[model samples]
Target chain A: GAGVSQSPRYKVAKRGQDVALRCDPISGHVSLFWYQQALGQGPEFLTYFQNEAQLDKSGLPSDRFFAERPEGSVSTLKIQRTQQEDSAVYLCASSLGAIIRSKNIQYFGAGTRLSVL
Target chain B: DQQVKQNSPSLSVQEGRISILNCDYTNSMFDYFLWYKKYPAEGPTFLISISSIKDKNEDGRFTVFLNKSAKHLSLHIVPSQPGDSAVYFCAAQHNAGGTSYGKLTFGQGTILTVHP
Candidate 1:
């Protein structure tokens, strides 16, 4: 695809179950980020990946949330033991550069909506 | 505590008119600000951005103004169109060095409705 792509647009999981969401960033992009958006709220940053290195994970709410980008192109966000509060849209974004450049804009993917019942 | 806040939950404007959306942030270290537009079932699309050093940045009909002293920013859309109706988000980043990276702290978005 020409832009960032995310898999499993919708996922329904029972409480205590685990789920994994995938994101395929724009080809050759070096930066990737994951955010979670609850109902009627803005997306909150979760983690960031620069190429294959996980540089920042400060915004992650809990230890149950995990993300990785082994090759720096595709990334995955996994939530363990889902709770009702975990039900939200998980968004993925990618930028071309690692530093703050003049045109470093992050392009987002149509997020994966998760429902924890 | 909410670092970034968009107090107005919604805004309505008529076509061909100007629409202003406002945001405020408590973090003084933030140096980069961005505005994003999102549609239902779609991801947020980048709109405009302004660096803390500049008070204003303009791109076509969209302009973003920053007030460092007030810790506030506003996005102006001139001649609003129906297509511009969507949720707008204000995001801030502290781009000091490697410590901050590009993680964005976003404000609760504002819903903009453009009536034709």
Candidate 2:
């Protein structure tokens, strides 16, 4: 793909329901990131991946939030027992290289807006 | 605590005028800073960036000025256009090492409205 892609642009889930969001990063990109953006706020970091390795997960809000990039090209973010507080836009981004590299500019997807009612 | 802060929630400017947006950070470990512009229903688009080694960086009309001593940074858009109207966010990254390498700490966005 020419840019990062996210699926199910909008989702409506009931409280306590589990939901999964998908992200497809640009081809050959080696690094990927996930962020959560609440209403009227900037996007906050969630997790990061370097190929198939999940190098960072400290930003995950709670045990209910989980993410995986099994094949490295596509990633999935799953939220278990979603609550109203989980309502936010989930964003996915990918970079050409690791942050230590000078060319590590992140490109973002349209993101999935999840509304937990 | 908010590691990054953009005190102004919104700014309005006439087309062709300069639009200056300010940001502040408390963490000294941030070695890279970036600005992102976002439109409604779309994800943020990368605008410009600067490394801590330099105090200023410019790309066409977009310029980012970093004052390391004050822990402040500002983005100046020369001859702003109506198309530039959107929410702008300031983001900082810690690339020194460790698991925090790629994590971006972002400030609350500032909505900019450039009127024609």
Candidate 3:
């Protein structure tokens, strides 16, 4: 892919339902990042993957949130028992660098808008 | 604790004027700072970035300034355009004895509206 691509650009979920958001990063990009953006706010870091290793997930809001990059190519963010606060845009980005020093611009995908009612 | 903070919620500016957005971080360990511009229906685009080693970095009309002493950083867009109106986010990365290579901590964004 030329840039990061995400699925289900808009999602409306009922309270307590489970929703899965998917992200397909640029081909050969070694770094992947997920973020949550509330209305009128910046994208907050959620999780990151370097290859298949989920090295840092400290930003996940709760245990109910889970993300995985099984093949080091595509990734999924699953939210269990979604709450109203979960209504927001979920963004996924990928960069060329493996680490911060070498990290090029983080190319972002059109995020998935999850609306929890 | 919000290690990164953007106190301004919104700013209105004329299209031709320079727009200044500010950000502050608490952690001194953060070595790099980045600014991102986001549109309504699209993901944020990386506008510019500044490493701690340099106080200023310029790319075209966008310039970023870092002040380690004040724990502050700012983004300046000269002759702002209506297309530049978007929510801008400031981010910082801290890698001190951590397994993470590039973990970004971001602040609540400041929305910039460049009216033509």
Q: Estimate each model's TM-score.
A: 0.97, 0.98, 0.94
Report the C-alpha lDDT of model 2 over A1-117, residue by residue, as the tens digit.
Answer: 889999999999999999999999999998899999999988999999999999999889999999999998899999999999999999999998754545888999999999999
Off by over 4 Å in 3: A99-103
Candidate 1 residue pairs that clash: none
| lDDT of model 3, residue B55 | 98
How far in Å is the alpha carbon of A33 misplaced in model 2? 0.6
For each candidate in turn, the interface RMSD (Å) is 1.1, 1.2, 1.7
Question: What is the descending lDDT order?
Answer: 2, 1, 3
Binned by DockQ into CAPRI classes (incorrect, acceptable, medium, high), candidate 1 is high
Q: How well is each residue in A1-117 modelled by candidate 3, as lDDT tens digits?
A: 778999999999999999999999999988899999888767788998888889889889999899999999999999999999999999999988654464566889999999999
Overall lDDT per candidate, in order of appearance: 0.94, 0.94, 0.89
DockQ of 3: 0.69
Candidate 1, A1-117: lDDT as tens digits: 799999999999999999999999999998899999999999999998999999989988999999999988899999999999999999999998755555688999999999999
lDDT of 1: 0.94
CA lDDT for candidate 2: 0.94
Model 1 chain A poorest 10 in a row by lDDT: A96-105
